[model samples]
Target: MAAAPDSPLYLGLDFSTQQLKAAAIDGNLRVVHQDSVQFDCELPEFRTQGGVHIQEDKLTVTSPVLMWVKALDLLLDKMKRAGFDFSRVRALSGSGQQHGAVFWRRGASQTLNQLHPDQSLHQLLQGSFSVADSPVWMDSSSTQQCHDLQAAVGGALKLAEITGSRAYERFTGNQIAKLCQSRTEVYRDTERISLISSFAASLFLGGYAAIDFSDGSGMNLLDIRTRSWSKVCLEATAPHLDCLLGSPLPSSSVQGPVSSYFVRRHGFSESCAVLSFTGDNPASLAGMRLQQGDIAVSLGTSDTVFLWIQQPRPALEGHIFCNPVDRQAYMALLCFKNGSLTRERIRNECAGGSWETFSAALRDTPLGNNGNVGFYFDTVEITPSAVGVYRFDSEDSEVSSLSPQVEVRALVEGQFLSRRLHAERLGYSIIPGTRVLATGGASSNKEILQVLSDVFNAPVYTIDLSNSTCLGSAYRALHGLAAESGASFFDVVKNAPEPQLVATPHPAAQQVYDHMLERYARLEDSVLRKSCT
Candidate 1:
């Protein structure tokens, strides 16, 4: 629906792997309009599968840079056709998939700044990129660079301490190193490097937008503690790197006013402010209205657990990024590859492909599943790095079969147990008033949420919207304006609708999960040892 014409609106855009999405909200924090353009569906001319091209080696993956540019054009036109009131939009912010890098060719800044209102962004900036395709988070082709970086910085642990993460293969610094080594001419000709988040913001700002610290933390080059680029790490990545990467900005920094192109073509007000954009995960945190002591569990195709942190413990596993809402705080994230699909497989086998039956199994089973636990991984898992299905009984004895009801409960309990165990390993502990906010496909199941509440020993809530990333960007848009007047993010969004309270912890939750958690950790370790052998 069109927003009330006079209501001051905030706009948030998400440039994700497969789609470019937009959400606009009024000052009261109500989402008024939404739109998206899917790359593979809308732009079939790119001939992309899942919006990316997987190279022959299969380790390297990328998306056409121009495809993203064209998506923005299409998205704006869509909003215009729908009678969106761009003039009412007072501020804007956005998010992009983390760890992707975009290289601007020398003199491209001039082309960006002088964009003519008559031409589309894609048509005007056709030759603006030094690298036609950007290396995205899915690309894992920089293993050699990862090794060299770890070696140069002492070791993986030390590197993690310095840069909030070890030298990950898909990290921008390692990706940049790979480009410098393999495609020297391209790196040499590159005038500036923008993380995907900053690249999207620049499109609206009509100039280069500074990389926000939240997204910059994913590059394995920024010192999370200092909130600045690490000179040592920069030297290891490439020559003259500081200039190529402009100074990182706070995620809530007001970048500037809307570009002339947007003002003239889209009817956006020239006075509309553009705020720094951040990574999708960080934006979701904002959208979820996460506060200190709150944990957000996104139960998508791959389940992710993230929380706000006052004291970050950088680890070899998981990641630490600057908090988008609170500059002094941090965020830790953990991903489980075995999520909804694995659950679906079990549901089909045990419940005749019925979610109702699957939920009934959960409601009927006792907490902790009577000492039964199962580890289900149809593919190689990211955490604990194990594969194949393994079941154990009360005695910790490996078993080949389980009763259908027991199997269903085991899968649900084990997944939540692992999330709690790993999140704690990253130095997250359940404290007083801690709330677990759950979002994703599986979160709709009340029975599943009850189990999540029992496992975490906290009240569980569900968001009103599914697209937290885009919604969060809209929240961030308001924050950029309010923060300048010394308002906290919580203060800015306090009047928004509260997440629905879905489940509360059972009185015996702590007592039940404590013993099971220890046992589950031991079984996971045992599986890891067997995998290594």
Candidate 2:
């Protein structure tokens, strides 16, 4: 049976580093309208002197809170242009870039409200922060802090055993420690430090500070089993956690109603409820209709491989990230910093011409590139390691020494092989029966998709949705609303649109991939051993 046409529209806002993207979805899980607005981050002044990185002393960079507010306003305008009825929007939630901190002052409401021509609450909160841009997840300057916290909690493996994750430079707890060490004055003035998702939700609902489990898990401060802030982790890192942190909430809970001020300013009706916000990746998993044995691969500037697991698994060799989206689902994630960009570089510099030309080139080249050649694509490694290294190698040194074309193919094949190995290590059986959903820029490349399919010997699927991240956020918003009215979360997802295409692996190519994968594993081990020593 079809869902009723009168079902309420759910609004999802994806808060990324570069832009804010908004989407509206109906009860049938169809996207009705979508739009995005770009925002700029103030660059910090830095210099390279005497082979060491130096930053201007007392330097503080911050994002204009007006940017988010303006983004919201522009989204509303775009929605109106798309013929969407703002009043029909039933529930709203957000998915933000995980681990970015936003500080809000407790007693400055009167001061905040009077400061603006624009009624954006995000802008009003700007005055409350000493630093504009908090150390985002991409910032890896907190390596020392990560090492310190890991030692304090125990060893890296022991830390992962307890918290279900290992210490990383980007995790919130480490960033907080870094700030305290470097800028103690600013850390002292901090009031309520919240994740970007919770901050946005708080802004919309007037004033509240609570994060969903998915977002909290990314902080490295939450105990995976307890689903709450870990006192041991916090005390070991930042002892004075008083107002700097907030309570953790489930993703489906309604944090609060849209504030009257926000309603008056944005012309939104008072009937809308704000659902708890979550991490964008978790939201994407929900949006993809992910299940056990199902993997979702996102190939943007970076590649993230996500699988839903029933048990609380420890972070794999400090390479995997496990975070709970809800009570029933935990996401095991592997992210690669070098994904589509590496492929694009290969296409432009190596293959020459458009992506179609690149695809054709791969097809023209025989399986395994006709010999023992492979490509290593790495701008950085998000999972497994913070640094990235790329190299092309061949069993036949003559083949490795000769042709750049062979080297390019090798690199591409190596990337696919690396993903396969990583998946296998995580206990995912990458055999013929596994369901692999590929979404991102690389998914559009027939050659890459076919190569991936051939390598995995599994069916590769892609959907028509161009921006699956935005779609995922919209799906979460819808689910959040439905959960409020006694709807089963899994049932709502089971009714989502079927995948667009299913590309099966070629039997002939699988044997070649099997051999290449063995070589790739050996190469990866050597690289890791060399890097560590």
Candidate 3:
């Protein structure tokens, strides 16, 4: 007999950089209810800007641990007010901003187990973290730690071969090393270290949660092929690192039922299972159900372009993370740190802080901005490893001046052109007829996406929801449960809804960016070589 139509629902949460969002999906995989709490606006008590605090020195970027805990409390409360029935939520899994590590105090496990329904998580867990604030992914202060780690593990290539990417300063391993070196006593008192995703799941699990393989791939410690911690890499970072971090779990596997704390507090059943949480990008892949032919561009706080692949290859410019849906497959990614912030800055300078004017300027200026290409990096960029604004003429030569309208178009075109260039090197094919699927906050902007389509010379697409990470987490929960019930993941997603084509490449404009890509690549090479990255 077929299962009941009113089957238990699955809950997915995304602890993203700027906000905490939750989504509920029913047995049919349709989003039932969803809500979000923006950290900067909703939780001003944390005094965080853009969901982070950048130290005055400007290298350190962190968010208060208590603020995240409090966000959970507020999010859940808001969800309840929005008519989310916790009792119907049969399974929960989530995605979080990758690389950020949370240091649990020695007694944190005890605190988790003893959570009281009458109290908030932030209230009960005030002293649960060894570190009050966690070094987030935006932090690039671990430059020394990255070098030390690469040296300890032979070299950059060897380490990248083991992990997915090179020793990125924002990676958890380097961040942990920095913490240990900066505050030895706090590192000594830490009982467990959790990635941002697992840390959030541990709250519902009522104990330390294991890191999933996909998220683990972002850390410079996990051997991606084996899906386990690399001994040499671990030894290089910290002492007995394995003791602090539990074995990495496969993303498809279920962690366990929700703890009695949640059972008592929110009416969750003892039978409600919690799946292992992974990084937001990986989770977004699962949510988008990315296919081999499609390229996914996430335009959030950080702009990233990723595609699905079967084989893993070593590349310095981008990343190859284990697929969240399939343990065997891999996903290639190129992350640009100056995503929304850069766009916002350009808008402020050129359009007087109005996205409408920015869009109008983009449309007003002809595609390619008359052969002028601009690379805007308001912060340290991950792709080219460069910083600051750069403008170049038609011949890939540096130019001094441009109009605000021209600058706006150039910035948009330059961003997508760089992605196209690096992605090809990372083994992503960007042919004339390719399709680009867009998601995240900025993906909804048709004007911005039009530039993407024009530059890539491909049609752009968007799913029903812009925030696919949480929805994908929800889908993943149901998919895992369905897998246990004898249904395949591919079948579940394939039978689900298809993304709508949002924008098609302009025929004449496509030719312009197609030709400009070469110019952009030349300038990109010169800039990267000069930076000595």
lDDT of each: 0.93, 0.68, 0.86
Model 1 regions lying over 4 Å from their true place: 1-4
Q: Against the hidden reference, what TM-scores do the models get?
A: 0.96, 0.82, 0.83
Assess candidate 2 and give its lDDT.
0.68
Q: Tens-digit lDDT track for model 3 on 213-260? A: 999999999998899999999999999899999999989788888988
Candidate numbers, best lDDT first, in rank order: 1, 3, 2
Per residue, candidate 1 scores C-alpha lDDT tens digits across 1-533 of 55556989999999999999999999888888999999999999998999999999999999999999999999999999999989999999999999999999999999989999999999999999999999999999999999999988899988899888888999999999999999999999999999999999999999999999999999999999999999889988899999999999999999999999999999999899999999998998898888898999989899999988888888888888999999999999999999999999999999999999999999899998889999998898988678888899999999999999999999999999999988887768899999999988998999999999999999999985468889899999999999999999999999888889999999999999998999999999998887777
lDDT of candidate 2 over 41-146, digit per residue (tens)? 2212212122122244412222444455556666666667777666677788887787777655555444443444355454465576655555566667787888
Model 3 clash count equals 1
Query: What RMSD does model 3 have?
Result: 4.3
Q: Count the backbone clashes (under 3 Å) in each candidate.
A: 0, 8, 1
Angstrom error of the Cα, residue 37, model 1: value is 1.7
Superposed Cα deviation of residue 489, candidate 2 (Å): 3.2
- lDDT of residue 488 for candidate 3: 64
Off by over 4 Å in 3: 1-6, 38-47, 81-83, 114-119, 299-302, 337-381, 387-414, 430-434, 439-451, 454-457, 495-497, 503-523, 529-533
lDDT of 3 at 476: 89
Clashing pairs in 1: none
